[model samples]
Target chain A: MNRAHSKTKRTAFVVAAGLAAVTALAACSSSSGNGGGGGDSGPVTISYGVWDDTQGKVMQQIADKFHESNPNITVKVQITPWDQYWTKLKTAATGGAAPDVFWMNESNFATYASGGVLANLSDKLKGSDIDMSNYIDIQTKAYTFDGKVYGIPKDIDSIGLWYNKALFKAAGVAEPTADWTWADMVAAAKKLTDPSKGQYGIVAQSAPQQSYYSTIPQTGGQVISDDKKSSGYDTPEAIKGVQVWVDLVNKDKVSPSLQQMTDTDADTWFTSGKAAMIFEGSWAAAEFKEIPYAAQNANVAPMPKLDQPGGVSNGLGNVMSAKSAHPDAAWKFLQYLGSKEAETAQADAGIVIPAYKGTADGWVKAFPEFNLQVFVDALKNSSQYPSSMNSAAWQDPIELEFNKAWSGDETAAQAAANSAKIMNDALAAEK
Target chain B: MTSQLVPPVEQGQRRPTPLPPRGTKRRSLRHGDRYWAYLLILPTAVGLTVFSIWPAIQTFYFSFTKWGTFGGHEWTGLDNYAQVFHDPELLRSLWNTVIFSVMTLLGIPLSIGLAALLNTKGLRGVGVYRALYFLPVVTMPAAIALVWKLIYNGDTGILNQFLAVFGVDGPHWLSDPATAIYAVGVVSIWSSLGYNMVLFLAGMQSIPGEFYEAASIDGAGPWRQFFRITMPLLTPTTFFVTVITVINALQAFDLVYLMVGKASPAIEESQTVVYLFYAKGILQGDGGYAAAIAFVLLALILLITAFQFRVQKRWVHYE
Candidate 1:
């Protein structure tokens, strides 16, 4: 009887333990915590998140300067890399644990603004001494949604043809002229490539933003329609433009294959003198400056044209986060960043071309040996990277298919069609 | 149910003081045994509840909601699940996963062959060979991916560079879609080979030497002995390894993610189901849909595991 009773008691205990485990498991979904809302007057410690460690240093300097002016506001800088920045920001934003301020990318601005996460800074800008008119109009509009200014333009970067003067001299070719056409570049590339000696002409990349779209206007093609609906990739001009990139590998053999470029990053190839020419953004100038060969041999020129009757250029700019807690401090910081003062500071860094109206003069003086004048000229007409709703959702799928097309696994037409369908569905889903 | 059927048996031989009254004494002893058993399992149970089960439940709940912009979520019913059917990306990823899973299956026989070689009783310096074989398993997957990428480099890779001496130009191992999946799968097999071999070795060691000796005395060959005795008896371990390998292959993301990041030209050919989940959930901010995908993945695994158990009787001979 005693043993039987003990067994029953043990069974009951086992049942109780199983019940507790299930109960605990069921309770896992509930979350607890209060959001750190900004107080009206107390010591406001705002967290600012930005990508680019190089820019982060400049931001910190600006914050330090702001601290000198406004002692009450303390800003904390959070530096997340480009790959993880937007993802981490969105996750943290949804959880209400986001940094008080964050950097905004043109690609991600629409998604965040549409979701009502950003604060309306239109009234703040209009009422304050921070003049929005001081910056370029296109850049100011890139961060605006529904007629409300959600972000302040910080800086601008445009793509330019970076060439090695030594490579040019070695190949018995003249330096890249400002008025060079696409034909001239091809001829230059052929002259530069000496495959027998392990040097290539250029790095042919299928990247839509930096290289492809930069050449689109040259071929009289726009990446997306102005209304931002329907496919721009299937057009004749765009296809012709894209072919220029692909032909360097497939036809001309002047550039390394797509696989080679992907394996060894194009920039690494350029910096190492393995490639003579590369289409890199002004943002890369500082990195180039660090490479010994780049310091002595590299110089910038505006992108070559397609021999079209009339064509121009454009570029993208940096924008500040709208959901910042320290709005006043952010405005002040952005004002300083856009001032000729910050432009001189950034230009001295030798990595970026300052976006302020008269900032190019400072950069020209800073890098006198290099043709920094080309970047300044390019700024007069460079086109912006197209932006639209569901760009991330649309572009990623298209790029995935495009990679297949590049690999010859899928034809360009087939990939384009598939990409269009995918983009359409993704855009429709957002509705 | 098993606990209820099997009555607890405690022998009184070790204890000298035994004489308390029936009802109260039995209850106290039962409580004491229950307390100790609970104490023994407390840590593991707590850990599972805290880590696995809780998160699983949360994932399920999160699946059925629309996320708010700046925190919290509103219930969105089965919309997230409905969206899954419409997601072409998910379909492509699932197809890719199937191909990868089938490719990784080749690792099993390869591991068995390796285990068989190392299990040879008189093999000299077997320990060093085993260590070398097991290196990939212990090394970080990221490091393995990076090193393998360099080795597979089209131009300057050591593999291709070596091939050039023999007048053989190696194909772009990772960049070519036709070869990319196979190349990645090869790395996956290499990484898991050591772990699977170790498990097989442990199972092989547990088998008595007398069986082999007895078979030898009967004039039986190694092949005959392996087929008739060794193979049948190794069923349980084989089942465990197969189940684990299948689950691991299903969840293969890290190697693919580390090797071919989002910007890689080979991403289309190399993406796995979990990689798709990560891209959509974390990268794209579609958490609800991602949660739905997760649950679907979980259900698929459970169904497959159940199917495996159902069919085990056919091939898994229990000695």
Candidate 2:
């Protein structure tokens, strides 16, 4: 009787515990639902996602500013680092829980826009005061798909030649100038290279955007056709562009070996005083400012010309999730983020060159040590950063094939031909 | 349901109380008890189904489908599998995984030797030595990979500096295709040695002291005792360690991802199957192909584990 009574009590206790757990779970979900399903008039909070930690602070300030004018709506800033940002965004979008607003890059913009996860802003812009002309042309165009704009231009970046003045002075080589051509740069690189001191003239990284993307166009070649239907790597101009970098490593021996560069990135080499020159983007200006050695000696110059002044330019855009519960709030915040006041604040932060045309002056002045104007000026002659609906598929394989050329195992032409075939196949498969 | 619950309790009670629980009231009590047992297990069972079994089923289903960039997927039958079979990159990664597994497995003997040394009688500061060896096991893999990357740097690395002291020029350990995988494998072995040694120590301590005393009395030296008694007794632990090491090595991704990186010239040679899966699925948005790669890895791991289990009977001694 005692044992039976005890078992009966235990059973009742267990049943009660299970019910409590279920109730707790139910309460949690219901509260979250309430938070997400805020009515049109009630207080609502929307999230804005970005990648860079340096820029995330400025974003928070902008969010605070947006909240001030609209007291009923709150804005939250969320930052995910660059490496995990895309993967997290994809997973969240799949689960219908992506942030209300987030930063978008050109390379991944097509995939996201085509996926229909991004909110179409074209319809919203028709009734709003925001002008598309207010943003950089390339940025606005990059985010447009199927005659609809999906993102607001946030910031723009362009490639430039970053040289260490101290290294040039020590080697008795002339400083890279605006009128410098590819031949002049190469000659100076030869003079700057000193094997005895274990210093290289430059780092010929295999980075597409910073190196070959610019060089390819400079040599009068295209990466992908403007129509995004075919690859131009098989063209003789493309081969010459690749050969320019390859020869620096294997022929002229002016740059660090491909193996050495692979061990340490070009940015590290330049900052550590191991290399004299590196082709870097404007986004690097803030980072270089933080490095004492780079801040003291590094300065930017126009990218050395080949056929013509050439570089690749790209930009970031702010996008809203299609499924955002607070769509009205998100759009308001997005508009505020693209406003001149917010852009001027961003420029003042010195983290990025705001896509708002006149706001970039503050960014240029923020870093007085380096010639930040070169990046803004390069924007005029630079081609758009090449991307397709599925760029990474072709880009990854092309880099692998190019690594062989970089390592001196294959000629540049052979690698370029192989890359062309692979790229074309990938492009064909995209449809 | 009441009848099923009553019988088990009745059987258990029959042995204890001998026909004391024959009434409907007792039967109802037993039924309630069964419900209680189920309720207690309900949370764990739900968790397992949701997190493990359900995902496995979904992944198996996804393996047959082509996924769009967003959420949706369409059935494609065996197309992704066929692509996986033909991919040269997949083949290379598979080969790299095998080489890495073999290299890590080679550390087991070294682990056993260290465990035996630490288990030696009258050893002082055994706790300190054991703690020192176990440090890497607790350290994050990312931290270890980053530190090792700096050490293996070609021009300005501590490893090269140490080598230079001996009048030897070291190859670029991580950048060169010929040396990258082996360099990573060395770090893998070093990091896992502490974990394997601890397991061996536990196995060694469990072996009867009487057996060793008997061996000594039978005119056996230390080496003889080790060969005859310790080696045979250690077989079970060794088998367990080898199986786990192989599984871990085959799943190697984090260290390679951090150390070799996507831009490295050595990446082509050093990347494992899991890394390739990540590159294809997560980085490249080829979910269907990545799922197919994952299933292949699963199949490979199952086959290798089964082979190890089959081979273990020849050497593993339970006694």
Model 1 stretches with alpha carbons more than 4 Å out: A1-43, A307-340, A361-369, A408-431, B1-29, B32-51, B61-91, B219-229
Per-residue lDDT for A251-328 in model 2, tens only? 999899878887777799999998999988899998899999999999999988888667678899999999899999
DockQ of 2: 0.25
A22-60, model 1: which lDDT tens digit per residue? Answer: 233233223332244566366566667788888788778
Best by TM-score: 2
The TM-scores, one per candidate, come to 0.84, 0.91
Expressed between 0 and 1, the share of native interface contacts present in candidate 2 is 0.37
- Assess each model's interface with DockQ, reporting 2 decimals per model: 0.22, 0.25
| Model 2 lDDT per residue over B83-130, tens place | 998999999999999999999999999999999999999999999999
lDDT of 1 by residue, B74-151 (tens): 899999999888877788778788788888888988888788889987999999999999999999988999999999
Model 2, first chain, TM-score of: 0.91
